[model samples]
Target: MNSTDSRASAYTTLSRDSVHEVEIKRSRFITYLFRVESEAQAREHIAALRKTHFDARHHCSAFILGPDRMIQRSNDDGEPSGTAGIPMLEALAKRDTGHGTDLSDVLAVCVRYFGGIKLGAGGLVRAYSDSVSQALEHSTLHVRQRLRIFTLPAPHALAARWENELRAAGYQLEPSVWEAAHAVLHIGIDDTEHDAGQLAAFTAALTSGAGRLQPFDTKWVDLP
Candidate 1:
């Protein structure tokens, strides 16, 4: 892949849990998605679903976690070996969040309600993958960016205007705080992105050469 595509495929996660269902030959496959920050959360979600869908025959699941997308786990949950959870996991792995990143911190579970018919291994795989894919269609995605938190000092007189204008120009800003004579504007910038020159020029023009932007910390921010 090119550098642009490679960068875009870095990290992404689900904005919320989503649900979608499908039927094949009367066999019902209900796919559920959950946003989980850790393995404990994922396990809790799976347990909750087990209680809610008590009659479900199988509750196959898969999960991927961390900012680096380093953790992954899958469970067959009583389904035929390699037929349900593996396909569900692969389905999530193949998903693109459309923000140049792979999906993470999410779990997918497929609850199967037997419909008096049996699907072979291949059919089960297709059903599980397709069910998760369908659920992802209704899921919202968030982009995760490693960014530098900055404090920009603005004249109190221009604080409101600058807040509106800077945000409108695509800068993510936190609330402004009055400190003596200036309004300190908290903002975040993706230092690794190719917007340094543009951001510098914009800040200079906005503050009329008086803006002092300083980095406070580095963190990962989620963008919808």
Candidate 2:
């Protein structure tokens, strides 16, 4: 399925790409974490890593994409079956975002450099899982909020005066569009009944019943 296909209203994702390494039994497990929106991006990242770490023995990988997490994939890359990739994927799926939201749009790849001491099935699983878990612990994360857009048209002077007031009132305003007669202020707010009511009431009061909010499509915005 497409990454944008049945998205959640809000979700958690990595703030940036990160790499964390660990040593187990003399073998190096380097975990790369990337925020990805599609399977193709995840695959591209894995391929790049394989090229960068060409000497590594194995490059096991897993990815969870889409806000709804509808696309989940893992590859063992010659590691024992169900040991490396599955555990890595589970680490991402079961990650605690502290806000109770599921983690998505993330890809984890563990490149292993053999140290001649082999980890058995259980050991491999634990090692790979720990590799991703530790990497995630060090990686920064944030939430994506889907906000509804509203446009309020007003005279340029009034728009300028109200812009600061709106910001002070905690309203999220996008850049305004200016026309000959007026300015269109783009406002973004949570797609909730309470927020809608508050915005409509506030705008009406600000304009003394002359202003009206024009609803537009929703967009996803990032929040720390």
Candidate 3:
């Protein structure tokens, strides 16, 4: 699979950690969904769950890391090969949040409590996939975008007015920092040429060529 899709400017992930449980043929599948950023975090969560549910038959897991969703891994635990982990991984990989199937930085674990019923390979696959699907259904999703930070300095007299104007223009503004001579207004715009040009023009119009936007740092930020 491609590391990142060029279509969507942002990616989707779980809004918060969540749990959901589903039962099939008396077998219990308790799913835990965690918002993780790295392989270490994912492993830590998995280990914690294993300790918590130490008596469970299996603790199958799958995780996709990185903003690009490039790091993908899954574990079957004691379940048959490809029946548990692969399906769970596919469920997460194919999840679409209106933007596209770009879900990343999430780890899913399905703890199974065997109920004396044996689910064949197909049934096991369905059970694992359904486990994650049900958990996601109960999850709130949010978007993360790469934002370009810019600082625009304005005189004390016009700082508040410029802040209001920028907000009205739908620019994301951070709290302004007050300095001795001027107030520095921090803004976050989508890391795209279109947004950059718009912000530059707007700032120029506000300061009449006296003010310039200084590019700050770019980082991935969770959107509300």
TM-score: which candidate is best? 3
| Residue pair clashes in candidate 1 | 8-100, 8-101, 9-100
lDDT of 3: 0.91
Point out the worst 10-residue segment of candidate 1 by lDDT.
1-10
Model 1: how far is 26 from its true place, Å? 2.9
Worst-scoring 10-residue span by lDDT in model 3: 1-10
Q: Is candidate 2 or candidate 3 better by TM-score?
A: 3
Candidate 1 vs 2: which has more TM-score = 2
User: What order do candidates take by TM-score, descending?
Assistant: 3, 2, 1
Better of 1 and 3 by TM-score: 3
Each prediction's TM-score versus the true structure: 0.83, 0.92, 0.94
What tens digits encode model 1's per-residue C-alpha lDDT throughout 23-60? 99898999999989899999999999999999999999
Summarize candidate 3's per-residue lDDT along 1-224 as a digit string, tens digits: 11343544578998999999998999999999999999999999999999999999999999998777889999999899999999999999998777554899999999999999999999999999999988998999998988889999899999999999999989999999999999999999988877888899989998899996899887788888
> Stretches of candidate 1 above 4 Å error?
1-10, 158-165, 205-210, 219-224
In model 3, the runs with Cα more than 4 Å from the true position are: 1-9
lDDT of 3 at 57: 92
Off by over 4 Å in 2: 1-7
RMSD of each: 3.3, 3.3, 2.7
What lDDT does each candidate get?
0.85, 0.92, 0.91
